[model samples]
Target chain A: MLAAARQLLVREGPGAITHQRVAQEAGVGRATAYRHWPQPDQLLLDAMGGADLPLFKDPSAPIRTWLHRQLRQMADELEVRAVAAMALTLAHSALWDPAIAHRQAESVRTIIERILVATRSAVASGELETEISAVDVAAMLVGPIVYRTTMQQGTVADDLIDRLLDSIGTWRD
Target chain B: MLAAARQLLVREGPGAITHQRVAQEAGVGRATAYRHWPQPDQLLLDAMGGADLPLFKDPSAPIRTWLHRQLRQMADELEVRAVAAMALTLAHSALWDPAIAHRQAESVRTIIERILVATRSAVASGELETEISAVDVAAMLVGPIVYRTTMQQGTVADDLIDRLLDSIGTWRD
Candidate 1:
């Protein structure tokens, strides 16, 4: 069932995952699919649990390089038709509800923590302006990408990150 | 029909809006509603035209004051159950789709232009950091807020903006 769910999510996008479709796609009985996973979101969360994100690596690389690489990975995720499709459905469905918001905050905080860890070194090395929390910096980095992603897909140009770093006097090879 | 649609959006959310509901709510026949709006999106768009947003104001006020005031207004809007309700539905339904994304880009660009205009003035007055375009400054101000808004519902804390301002050396009395 899980494999079927992952296959469906990756192959067709989130909107295509009805119980009947999953059953047919997985070659299982309809009742079996519903019994195992009642909704697409539950199945999606299960699938996302094991999917890999591009890990930040090469500490020897310049901070700007690392940042841009990380951003590019996010852009790739956003541009994926299936991921974007499912994400949009989830956003509309239960993501913003109070119950889900409370449950997800813990995970979101963890994601921010990972970003803060990377940014702490940049601040120490004078690559980032001091005084602003690493959290805000993460927000600054991710915000425009998301804004462009939802407001205008694929509108983030190549020069934006470099320009922002330059403005902060942090741009360097 | 528009009034009915508006009532449905505010009362039951965008998902609750259908030709049947609007017709019943407006005391009109179904054909009349369909004739007026071939699609529900047209009605929804019309209903959203007059939403009162917290606009940037007080030209003489310090830039930080103006920003904080503007942010407070956004927080207010986010907290409004109905607006948030409809926004989430719209986000899922069409906002992330390719067609809506292309159309929304120009308006989003205009919003950015307004922020850039404000940031340009602040740069001249030594209120904002130099060398960065107003566009980057605007991104800094907006990214975190939107991140918090979408990722965690209404998690923009009262002091978070101030901390960001202070960190960026934009904090002023």
Candidate 2:
């Protein structure tokens, strides 16, 4: 089960997400686990996809404030074991397989889409102005977070969010 | 040998970087490889570190131009087989071993140090100004590239470099 995969990832790291360990943890036969998820990477992806991090909240707030809060929340979540699994997923994604890399890019696109929806709302609400597309703005916000996390510096500073927004060319209503 | 290790990583992926494969590739006995590296991760680190990346050139040029050229060179190199090998080393680096992670962190620090030197030069020349430390400005430069690379995005946009420098509070001398 995905729960078993996630628990193993959190408790033992990415190497422990074998089908056998997950099946054993979930009280399922090895064949059963393999029948649904063929490779450990598939199970690992499912588990990372299912991590229960907080999401965008306070939609009524100014767009910049809402985004800042969302990023801050994401930073807080990274302090936990979930970040270890996510970090491993992001890092090892380069398996030299185009299929795998495409899948990884698609998954990243999903997160970017989530940010874009809010950014569009910000644009409509007069809290933001930018020459870049919403998609590029999302990259501007999330790119540094991924970078800092990969570097293992363990914190995304408050000013980083400010700078990222400033770089996006935001303006007063 | 490190050459053998790099060959396996470029040809295959991180999963292929074992003592046996490296030894076989290098025309040496497995025992000989083991005597040198002992652990597969150590071999992986050596191979990744040994990649022939282009480094900073023309330090006498304006610091911003020199720094941008360095990032651009790094991006150009990412287009080759070296990226596959480098990506694997970064991704699978989180095999849940603190000792291994610590060792990985130490290796990463070397590269960050290189970026810091250039950024410090930029600051000292008044080509850039920021409340953030030079170490962080380096992160701002490197993070987007890593994020794009990890996502399998083929290019780091030219404007991304521009925006990053802009966000760092760059100014005319």
Please provide, for model 1 over A1-173, each residue's C-alpha lDDT reduced to its tens digit, 9 standing for 90 to 100: 66776677556544455678878888999999878877655666556544332334333336777777777666566665555555555555554465545445554565567666666667667666555454555565666666556644544556766543443334433
**For candidate 1, what is the interface RMSD?**
3.6
Interface RMSD of each: 3.6, 2.3
**Per-prediction DockQ:** 0.30, 0.39
lDDT (Cα, tens digit) per residue for candidate 2, span B1-173: 88878777665645567788888999999999999987555676677665533355336547777777777766655544445345546546545667556656765565667666766677788876767765566667766666666553657777777776677776675
Best by DockQ: 2
Q: Quick one: best lDDT, which candidate?
A: 2
Taking chain A of candidate 1, what TM-score results?
Answer: 0.62
Clashing pairs in 2: A91-B91, A92-B91
**For every model in order, what is the number of clashing pairs?**
0, 2
Q: List runs of model 1 lying over 4 Å from the truth.
A: A1-46, A49-52, A55-64, A80-82, A96-107, A121-131, A163-173, B1-47, B52-54, B57-61, B79-85, B96-107, B120-137, B162-173
